[model samples]
Target: MTAIPSAMRVIDVPKPGGPDALTLAERPVPAFGDDDVLIRVAAAGLNRADVLQRRGAYPSPPGAPPNPGLEAAGTVAAAGRNVREFKVGDRVCALLQGGGYSEYVAVNVGQVLPIPGSLDFIEAASLPETYFTVWSNLYEFGRLQRGETLLVHGGSSGIGISAIQLAKALGSTVFTTVGTDDKASFCEQLGATRAINYKTQDFVAEIAALTANKGVNVVLDMVGGSYVARNLQVLATEGRLVMIATQGGAKGEIDVLRIMQQRLVVTGSTLRTRAVEFKREMKQRLLQHVWPLIADGTLRPVVDKVFDLADAPAAHAHMESSTHKGKIILKVGG
Candidate 1:
């Protein structure tokens, strides 16, 4: 058996600020509980949430490490006494509550899954955070149905790509907004029916034209601020607006009369703060419904770039630039 190390290096934000605020620090390897497993991380996904946490806008949940990471993939180095689904030497990826930016992470079995198909650790690491979010917010909580039309803001984003592919594969039409024509083209190729260039084109007008003024069934918006009012404009009567992030700004004025008349539903959630049992259920659903799609090549992770563990600052900068499409990953052990 391979000997377990007592210490590990982790990316830490001793003081939250810009990308440069992130630093490498040494810490003792996390200990596992009865239902937990110790995973030797190969790669970790870099997310907008991590960026937010780095900026001091979002903090790690209570009981979670202050380091900023939400998902990782590698081999299970040790399984606890109550963990039967995984064992030492199993290849797996996990959705974490925080602290995935390390050589090892201790996570409950409920938040973990075997790596799907022939994917490498980098690809597996890219899956958990966004997939868990989209599946939960867009499908389950949003109650988006097949045959519905979805309007996704930030089409080139990780969440956008995942939502687009999922909606398209599940028999729905997808319209998305992107900043550049290149991003628009990329999204269209990835299955978005119409990728509106928000810089040149007014999304509200474009969506109205595209849907013939009927608007869409659901709008997955990350840009809150004024976009909220505009999103409500593009939503059809009884349309649902599911917000996952507020990159634009949080406060906004909405038309309550329009909401009452149209019966629009406004809702949002933060996946990092959800219960483990809920995540476990989402994990099972991913295994049952989404894993086959990945295995069969119907749906796949779109990794934009990979940075070494020591170069996390650069990775965060790249993500902040928002020029890349799909997921950004931090290569750890591998």
Candidate 2:
């Protein structure tokens, strides 16, 4: 095993602003606990939450590292005394509450999974955040069943593409909304029944027409604001509307009458603050159900671009531009 270092490089936000605010600094390596494993991070996945953190909008939860990465893939440098599922030197990816930006991070064993199949560290690095979000929201909360139709907004995003492929692989018909025709084509090739160009098409009308006026069974949305009413409108009777983010804006107006009249389920959740037991259970379920698909190449992560750890600012800029089709990652180590 490589001897763990006493200190490691980490990205820090000196003050909230644009990508320029991100800078590299040295910090003591995080310590591991009885149930924790210390990862020598190879790469870390970037998410919108990082952008929020950079702008001083989203603060890391108490006890989480102040820096902004949400997921990482790496080899274990050490394991806690109580950790048994993974040992030192195991290749793994983890869902993190925060601190993925550092060269070393300590994660509870339950939040970690063995890297599936032949995926290199870069691709494996992109999995946890998007996959966990998709499974927990789309399957656990939404109860999206086989043959059910799911409409995913932000279809070109990390979360969107992950939800699109997984739902489609599991037998659900998937429709997605994207900003560009290129993104639309990419999403369609990834198994979306159709990718609506939200800029040019009224998603509500398109969904209505596509479903022959019946509406979809679920709408997995990240954009909130006015999309709330529109998403409610796009749901069939007894359908579900799962909200995972408020990228458009936190406040959204929904039609109470429409929800009541259609007997619809409107729900939203944030995973970072959820209890460890919940994440543990989710990891087990993903291992049993989704890991095989990943191992066999039926499902895979889509990495749009990679930047060296020092270029986190450029990576964040790319993400904010909203031009990428999938996950953006930071390569932290060789």
Count clashes in each candidate, considering only residues at least 3 apart in sequence or on different chains.
Answer: 0, 0
lDDT of 2 by residue, 158-259 (tens): 899889989999999999999999999999999998999989999999999999999999999899998998999899999999999998888889889998
Question: Tens-digit lDDT track for model 1 on 1-334?
Answer: 6888999999999998999999999999999999999999999999899999998989999999889899999999999999999889999999999999999999989999999999999999989988899888888877888998999999899899999999899889999999999999999999999999999999999999999999999999999999999999999999999998899999877999989999999999888888999999999989998888987889999999999999999999999998999999999995
RMSD of 2: 0.7
Minimal lDDT window, size 10, model 1: 135-144
Error of model 1, residue 299, in angstroms = 0.5
Error at 322, model 1, angstroms: 1.0
Compared with the true structure, all predictions reach lDDT values of 0.93, 0.94
If scored against the real structure, what TM-score would every candidate get?
0.99, 0.99
User: How many clashing pairs does model 1 include?
Assistant: 0
